[model samples]
Target: MSFDHEQRRPADYAAYGSDIDAGLQAHMRRVYNTMCIGLGITGLTAYVVASVPALASVILTPPLFYVVAFAPLAFLWFGFSPQRIQRMSAGEATRMFAIFSGIMGLSMATLFLVFTHESIARVFFITAGTFAATSLYGYTTKRDLTKMGSFLFMGFMGIFFASLINMFFHSAAVHFAVSVIGVVVFTGLAAWDTQYIKESYRYNAMDDSANARLAITGALRMYLNFINLFQSLLSLLGDRR
Candidate 1:
């Protein structure tokens, strides 16, 4: 998918370009709105689970806790992947996104149990501000972010492996290092995903179903960036109760 500039454009082209720009803006707004709603659901669900001992007992136990932790991964693979979700209609994708968001919230409840509310809120705002800044840069910049996407993905994989090793080793230093790298990787990812989503917009396609699928996909990407960024910041800066 490429957009080429002739450097010397025609009058007709500019008029058509204005219409496309409006469509792209509208599409981007939908993506962001959907992402915000999903985040709200996740945050609410997490808080509720954390506050209720009965829910916590059911969810936070050894076997169940493991399931809760891994469920979101399962959802991403089976439920939210492009091969599956792209084939899905707008309603179907929205429902799947909602379910995945809830699963993510269940996984995140452990954070509430482990950290103070004040610290969580503080780190969340920090992540939000950082995400907003980098994502804006991505959207507005003329430079392509495509090259960095693969490298950032590799960094994410490295962090993943280091985290798994640290889980067994119980190493604070390793964990701290992982958190730092995670922040960097996800920050880059926020920018890369934004640019990717922005560039994906085509001037010609106006199919509502296709647009909806794109919006859901974009929402999922941004949601992931926000959640991971918040978690990383929490690990680094959050004070324990």
Candidate 2:
């Protein structure tokens, strides 16, 4: 039942390698499917809210926009904290994920008013193509991605903190630089996360509860990467309406 590195067969990949491999593939598929469904909900919600002048006007205004802008971060801390979410039951995870995406959709609804629909669509497809290809590389490649994990985590934090500062500075060049870095970091993260998730699969005998939670964790990680990638590309490349 131990996932300890010393205990698990690092070389053998467990005795039932084929069965475990097949199970891992299925697990990864479920992770991806869950992430995509969450994204669909976010996108649909954003479009619906944005299309309605009343809703958009109410939500996109100052105090309300601030709440929307901050809601996802709050969700990350209060609801989806790493320690908390890793132990969450399937139903709890699903509900929390749905709520997080809903809040994000509300926050992002302003994009519809700010950018041309054509540009938003273009950036979305671009982000999707890039994420899919990079994630595939992570899943299929032989090279270990663990080495890149720490570096990418640092880059992610740098982007996040820099964003706070840029809120006031509002320098176009600084914004552009961060946007470019944001895309690169998130893309690399998507690949790394995919590989990590694939390699971290445990035996069914080992705690079924933890194994199930792993899929939810993987979906959340990949979803964050996709959302960040889309937002960064949209900021840099999307045309204003």
Question: Which one wins on TM-score?
Answer: 1
Model 1 C-alpha lDDT per residue in residues 77-137, reported as the tens digit of each score: 8768866878999999999999888989999998888999999999989999999999999
lDDT tens per residue, model 2, 182-218: 9999999999999888877744425567767888888
Instruction: Report the poorest 10 consecutive residues by lDDT, candidate 1.
Output: 1-10
lDDT of 1 at 11: 77
User: What ranges in model 1 sit over 4 Å off?
Assistant: 1-9
Task: Return model 1's CA RMSD, one decimal.
Answer: 4.6
Candidate 2 residue 33 C-alpha distance from true site, Å: 0.5
TM-score, cand. 1:
0.93
- Pairs that collide in candidate 2 are none
